[model samples]
Target: MRAHIRSTSMHPSGNHIDAEVDVRTLSVALLSGTGRMGVHLSAAWAHAGMDVRVCSRRKEKAQQIVDALLSGQGYSTGQIMVPPHPCDRPAPSASWRLQAGRVEEAADADVIVLASPFHVMWRTLEPLAPRMRGKGKIFIDLTNPWLNTSAPKGPRGQTLPPIPKAEPQASVLFHKTRFNDPTSSWCHAYRHVFWMLIHPTGPNPRCGERLGVELLGDPRAVAVCTAMIKAHGFKPVIRPGGCEVAPRYEISMLGRREKGPDAPPAAGSDPDGLIGPFSASPLIAVDALLEKAARHFR
Candidate 1:
């Protein structure tokens, strides 16, 4: 996509820096889109009229996600054979495509969402680091490092021992290992999470109203991520400390498991009467529980 270049003085830091970004065409590539969160976000973005490329180790699973979105929703579907040259494809269209090649094919995208398992995430991303640098691309971390932990559960069914206090935040580690260089000034990395527990109910389900997203990253990166989150119809929350405070969010998930009415609804199930009433946004509700966990577990 051709980006109308504009130089802006404002950056995440107060200092003046020349950051060139394409605000008009927003394309996203989900690196591990076969997973539940990846599929949900991909479908939401496609539904929001944004271009999305779904990639996975298994191309069949990625293609299935694209087909499911087109069939499950009333969205139109089109196919374009990606050429060898990245710039040969037509301008960004509000459509979803399956990447037939490796993760390297997604490097040209404006945004890359990393939703893979924590164990394999870095291994998958390390090789792509060279292509991602200086591309002004935004990398969003949605992987929960503690996902595989088998710690004892609390009375409320919350996972115990939160992620080890010594473990570094996933986003921070990603930046240090991959994009930590003077030449990578244009690249921005973010740590973000979204809530999508509600299921489609009745003739029309307002799933967006129940879901929310939280972003913590550089100012410019957060701005791009915020716009993407809002486009998907989810409330976007920005944490002031950026990635520095990401550990708190990690710890929060272990406090209290949302259950009964407030817990996330099952896939394809109607959540109309299944969910309990709540006055606050789900992000805030979860944060509150995490705060309590920090005190109790720490």
Candidate 2:
């Protein structure tokens, strides 16, 4: 699918002035930068030339991750400028800097990506809520609520655990209630469809372009989040009703039947393979999801 490019208009002053400009140089704060998914996402955004601030309990670990992201692998370190706070009267100037800081620093960023484990999420963000309130910032939730537990051993000692319940939307609601930042908004919870780790050497090592993201959030915030997803080189599939639809996605994946090694490709009308909703064309997947949702909801 073709990417959606945000449009900008130029005005004729003595100097060419931009009438409107997209937030291309978004400043992102990753609260859990040292985590597995956090590192990949932080690197991906930084690789796309955005100003990224990674936060961790240990500053050294955060700095190491940032350094690895900035290394002259295949990725280029884009220019950075310090922009004014988004809530300020005048539009902020864009600035770029690769740095690691405490959670407090994340309050000033335009975008905040939360990748902490489900159990620790609230405790981690409660203190920062005051700092983040009223910034009109966009918060992206990238957490799966399932706890890791061991299952019974199979004949080959390879038993898999049952899939856990999905509650991503509840996380978003909790954030809003605790933060209560009326000025700010949150995009839907998002998860990568593929499992490969992205790094400076190759951002999309697992052919991420062939996969897509599943998102549930406010339309406006979803649009912004979608742009960021596209910047990371994946198509984004947005479902309405915010985080409410996330459980269905989880159940679908959990209940799917395993295909034999020689199983043929699923037919267009098949619902069995709907659990993994990602596709090279995200709209089609979204349509399928909508149909499934309608049936389930009705």
Candidate 3:
């Protein structure tokens, strides 16, 4: 919708002069820029005065998101500069701009946030693990992996089992693999429960901006990110050590499939929506997570 492609040069040989922009334009490159979380993050960054570069398999989709950002907040008019000319491509004679290209964007992004599913992380990040590390970058993992089941344990009817292992151990942890087992009778026994995963958006609709996230990272980064996530009308929980306590802490916070734990009891029998853990949203859970994380550091 809005095009803001500027022409500049890169000094690859160190002899030529390419204009250096001010730090006001904090460079960002979104991997899955077309998704909901990606779109939201892009807008959030722009509102904070950061320059964002979103990437998608479909260049058209990438441009479309750019347009949405402009209309939603009325700040940017930047263009989506890519290859395979779709009429917007720079002319063949156009000079190369020194703006950090795609690879550099990935490697040097100030904050590399992952709002994608867990599998996406396992597939894509596992490969880029080497370059994704270092200082000044935040790799946000907003995926909740969960599942519930009943097992034959000593007494107490039935008990939850252990999930696969993970490392670094956040103050609050998450494990994904242990949820594959079939549902046990204990869960089915209380079948008359109603679980509604409704957004605070409620009836007014516009009042629904209260969404949050769970942050697990360095202390300073955790504090900054906690504030960052909260600014979006959501809660922020700092997960200490992040993956360190992953296996032991993941229980109830997230499920392998969906619905966190189970519905509240007062409703009775007919469990509604995705029945699982967390009566509150991820934002709240992350807050709870941060508390757990802080203890780890202590």
Better of 2 and 3 by lDDT: 2
TM-score of each: 0.60, 0.62, 0.45
The superposed Cα distance between candidate 2 and the true structure at residue 202, in angstroms, equals: 6.7
Residue 191, candidate 3: Cα error in Å is: 26
Worst 10 residues of 1 by lDDT: 77-86
lDDT of 3 by residue, 1-298 (tens): 1112233332222222212323233455666555544554555544444556666556666666565344332112222211111234332212211121232245466545544444343444444545644343444454333323212244775543332334322212321112111210000010110112112111112223322233343333343344344433444433334333333333233322223354222111122222222333345445335545554574
**lDDT tens digits by residue: candidate 1, 86-132:** 12233222244433334666777877788776656767877888887
Give candidate 3's TM-score: 0.45
The lDDT per prediction is 0.50, 0.53, 0.35
Using TM-score as the measure, the top candidate is 2
Alpha-carbon error at 19 in model 3, in Å? Answer: 32
Candidate 2 Cα misplacement greater than 4 A, ranges: 1-23, 73-97, 149-169, 195-205, 250-298
Count of backbone collisions in candidate 2: 9
Query: lDDT score, residue 187, model 1?
Result: 23
What lDDT score is found at residue 273 in candidate 2? 23
lDDT for residue 141 in candidate 2, whole number 0-100: 76
Q: List ranges where model 3 is wrong by over 4 Å.
A: 1-26, 72-104, 134-136, 147-212, 239-243, 246-298
